[model samples]
Target chain A: MLNYIAVSTIPIMIFIIIIVGVKEKKDVYNLFIEGAIDGLKIVYKIFPYVLGITVAIGLLRNTNALNIILTPVIPLLNKLGVPMDIIPLMALRPLSGAASTSLVMDIFKNSGPDSISGKMASVIMGGTETTLYTITILFAAAKTKSLRGTLIAGLLADSVAIITAIILINIGII
Target chain B: MSKIWSCIILISIIIAFLTGNPNAVTSSVMSESKIAVENIITLTGMMCFWSGLFKIFENTSLLEKLSNKINKLVLRFFDKNELTKEAEKNMSLNITSNILGIGNAATVNGIKAIEAMAKVNKSDKPSNNMTKFVLINTASLQLIPTSMIALRTLYGSSNPTNILIPVWIVTIVALVVGLVSISILNKIIK
Candidate 1:
């Protein structure tokens, strides 16, 4: 997908060159280079943070810290009527999907794909995203550190999703 | 950072467990690298695919057309309609992405819109208008829920679209509650 985006931008660059020729009456080549350079500049600024987060995710997974966090949250989630198997997704939602997918696979294998627990977890997986990924990319793009209620709002949204899923499933609403 | 807090909690629990407090690691938490990987691929693919689709829509002018239509509603919420033509187009793309249940994509578009908005703003910090934009993005409107539907299909559900109604209800409720709180918060902070 990343490769596709990089490839797709080429035509857009060509269109700019055409516009420069037809309307701007300026140097088309220079405009193309400037455009590419601007993109490269943005990429350079963003790469380091992306690398750091990726590594942090890797370390957390390797150390089994994700499970460690999910442990306590599970019982409370279950008591709240959340499907126990879906707890890992909540923990994974702050990191990367690479980590979340692995948890999903585990839930599927253990609980069987048809089980309510497995199904609910899968549904939650589809409906939500990792909070960190959304925050990091959006905030970094805007060059802002202050979250300004985004985190709380995102968690609340996911909580609603989970609760709704459980309630509906238990009632056989879905 | 939440990460640091999580690490501390993990270490404390592990130490407690090693000291014969095995209850520290509840039976509920279990790590499976394989399951996590599958979820990552599927969800990320869905997000990227939707984001890419939105970009395509922008290139096709569908986004701009929609933006013009939504301009009235946006004007009411934002209290401004002074955006340049291009800015309106960008804002439309961002808003549409949120309405489509693609938060990741919406954020990408939101960043672009913010930059455009900031360029036009006279304020040092984010403007009231900018705050309203962020509030709307954070409280995003979702309809299809492509990711959730994809997950349902993946798990072998007989009717994946069955989730649509429930998703719509909760999303509407969320958007309403989120908007109200942000409006209240906006007044308090001001």
Candidate 2:
């Protein structure tokens, strides 16, 4: 039942939006084309960032450097009941969406999408924003010199989301 | 970002050589770009479709109506008269689009909101309201999480939306913590 609702959510949303657009007598086709072009531009802008982060992460993973780096912390993570596989996702969630998404895909491939670690990764991905990127881009628009409390608060929120996700998964609350 | 990126790549390459796996580095460096391009291609379709749909929302009164509903809830975060009418509208639209999981649209509105707030700001520094707004954005109270769902489906999740409720719970927790912390920090920092 829950799965049914989840799958239908997007389709339902699109239907409603289309219905509303038609009711408003708007030229939905032209607007969609314009917005798609804007979307293409956005993707173009972020491609370099995505490429850079993806390759860096790929190197870290393929060279076994990530495991090596996490070796010392593995026991601590285990003690906390956090799976070692999700360490990269947790670390990268705040830094880069593209990196974290790639990490989640890796988790899905390695553990299968229904595994505990994969579920946790999915929740974390959905729960948190790319804090550093959003902060930089948003502040640049306003020309804010000092981040002051924003950065700290943003990270604190991310930490809370990560912790909450792990706990919820462990407790089988989800 | 540059610093972190360079450090990760450099450290990975160094470790590869030290670990006697320079070949692994070579293979990954060649393959990762292809993987990155593939990921972008996969993402482009979803992004374009959602952006187009959201554009329809924006062109009609749909987004405005939804944002108006969100504005009432958003008002509590700001001081009385702290926001200009334009700032309030853009912020509401930003938050609304964000909740709807149209991230590209949300970003456009978010930047507009910041610009509106900047006009009303007294000092060169960001105001408490501005920080609070950005904090809300960073909290990212998304309702749908479209990209994650799409990726899960692509990866062959038997139940792609299985994590949806948990994601919602976590997002709410994050937003509450973010707002509370920002409120406390605003008093302390200034």
User: Which candidate tops TM-score?
Assistant: 2
How close to the true structure is residue A94 of candidate 1, measured as C-alpha lDDT? 48
Best by lDDT: 2
Candidate 2 lDDT over residue span A97-173, tens digit each: 76677677667766877888989999999999999999999999999788989889999999999999999999886
| Residue pairs in collision within model 2 | none
Write model 1 residue lDDT over A36-122, tens digit each, in one string. Answer: 454345344444433333334433444455556667776776677766546546666546644565555556656655577765665
Per-residue lDDT for B76-165 in model 2, tens only? 878747788889889999999888877767899999999999998888889988999899999868899877887777778888887888
Each candidate: RMSD: 9.3, 2.1
Q: Estimate each model's TM-score.
A: 0.62, 0.92
DockQ of each: 0.12, 0.70
Q: Across residues B90-168, which tens digit of lDDT does each residue of candidate 1 receive?
A: 6777787666444544666678877777677664545556655665654426655555555555666565555555555
Residue B140 error, candidate 2, Å: 1.2
Prediction 2 global C-alpha lDDT: 0.86
User: CA lDDT of A121 in candidate 2?
Assistant: 93
